[model samples]
Target: MIKQGLLVRAAVPACVLTGGAVAGGVSPIAWATGLVFGLALVLLTGWGLQRTGRGEFGPADWITFARATLVGCAAELIADGGHPHAWLVGLIAVALLLDGVDGQVARRTGTSSEFGARFDMEVDAFLILLMCVQVAETAGLWVLAIGLMRYAFVAASWAMPWLTAPLYPSMARKTVAAVQGVVLVVAVAGILPVLWTVAAVVLALASLVWSFGRDVVWLARTRVPAARPSAIVAITRRRAAPHHGPTWPAHNQAA
Candidate 1:
């Protein structure tokens, strides 16, 4: 399964390089860079996935990474002017859909790991960042919200380190992240409005807020109860007798 996955990743760069070479117009630099980038991506992911599998490979991680890379590579091509020549929209859309699946796979397959989680997250973040950069070139700087949202969250973590914990996946948050890609792809493809760009930014921010809140709540509630207080401590806090008579009366000798 891992080998097959690596093969799939390699195909993208191979195709890009072969096509770029044949075109003979775009800089060989771009094609070479794409190849190197793709190679590095595959190597890094391949190693991570392998180590992850040492614990166990979840079907969801495989599917999620596959879908992410497929959509990601397609998005890159479309954003770079390989548009109209391929089903870039559908490609990107599929990637967005898969965003929700890998975690499911990981959970179901019992293959979830910290390494896998971070690995998958970084890939997703980079792909969105790539899309945002491409869109911003023409859509203006605001379009950058799509990509910068992750970085902004990372920045927030520096201030409040608590932001990093229990970053569990949420459907609403996933939807918001996916929208950033869809809006950028469609907008760049000339199908969406410039004003809609603002909506993307809004959703991205909202997701960050929701994620932070959810984490805080989860952390607050998930604490393991400490062992029942020692019997001695419990007894010390208890009164020896009910207050049938007022102790203050004795001190004052009023009665």
Candidate 2:
């Protein structure tokens, strides 16, 4: 059980600073600024609301939250027109690397909870969105499909309630999620030309579309009128059990 107070308290200051970071800018890149600050605020507030009760916040959450902060910073840098540097790449690479650490910390230390699971997933989704903004700078908006896929799925769920159903564990889904960050990071770091970056993002988007599509079709076929979430669901507030899988945030179980 997660107590609501902890996250809200800890996140308020960082969020305020992040807001000022957005407002103080002379001319922040529109897409970049909105993507970074918007996602950061959503993550902080959404996850804060999900956390409740009297559970220990745990080491894993701290690590994951730190990574999320770094992602917000990366987005801010892009908004300010700071070209990508080895240091920025390194920072994001660290965030990606630390993704695995949170899950492990939760499982081994027996600190896993629904809140932790959602926290991890939100961080992953937001970070992907931020990186997508950078990749789009060179690879075109087509590349954004990869980062936006998760959010798009969530939005569709609002209209199609069956899409909110918990999905079965799939290694393919986890692999696809992890690969998106690496490919986009590579593209953003200027490791690939625009052609390769767009091509790679397209492939990744296709895989994501396929994975989510399959899940949707399955949900449609097996829709249980009773078990369905509200039509207007809290997309990030999934009550999933924690899983120690290759995916940074894996598992599907109601709180």
Candidate 3:
């Protein structure tokens, strides 16, 4: 079953790349970049799945894989950057819409896993980054910071291992993550007046700053020094054990 999911993952990017090239007749280089990006996502995700213990791709995973394909296609369109078509915007809109559906499907289907949740988040981040790049031409380079902040945080983790600490989930973090994609897509699509677009983007960035700032402070306060791999494993195991709390009725619960 996992193999089937992997095959579907492979096919999606191939079809997207070929279809985009033939349909748009745009820059081959940009198409190639999108293909590479899509393939890389699939490969990286395969590794993540391995880390999740063992399970085949569930319905939610397939849906997210499809969403990731749309993100890759949108990235290609943004790379060429001639004019943003309604269709490219439409594609992104669908991807954003699907974000909500996957979680519900995961919970309903009882197949949620650490890998699935992380997969969804990484997809969200990449989409925001792609859209940020798309909007930067009109909104200015500062807009790129919205997308780059997550990557920046990851890089900072290298110098401060404390930054690598897992945060207790917050609704604020999820809300900010969702908002980043929406405002950036609006900004990229040029759907509003310049003033409104700028305002929305600014608001999005502010929320992001607040969200990340909160996480950083939390991680810093909670971080413990890891002197050994065994210590790290113990920390992870402790974190992974279930908490006593009310559980939701569904296939799986969203964090």
Whole-model Cα lDDT of every candidate shown, in order? 0.58, 0.67, 0.78
Worst 10 residues of 1 by lDDT: 246-255
**Model 2 stretches with alpha carbons more than 4 Å out:** 1-56, 224-255
Candidate ranking under lDDT, highest first, comes to: 3, 2, 1
Candidate 3 C-alpha lDDT tens digits along 1-255 = 777878877887888866765555568866787778877977888888788775467889888988988887777777775644786788789999999789999999998888889899899888888888877878899999998999999999999997765555467788888788778777877879998999999999999999888777755654645444454455445556787853323322222
Q: Please tell me which model should have the higher TM-score, number 1 or number 2.
A: 2
Which candidate wins on lDDT? 3
Candidate 2, 19-112: lDDT as tens digits: 5355436354634564556555555645564455534457777776677666666766666665436755876898898988999998999988
**lDDT preference between candidates 2 and 3, better one:** 3
Q: Rank the candidates by TM-score, best first.
A: 3, 2, 1
Model 3 TM-score relative to the real fold: 0.82
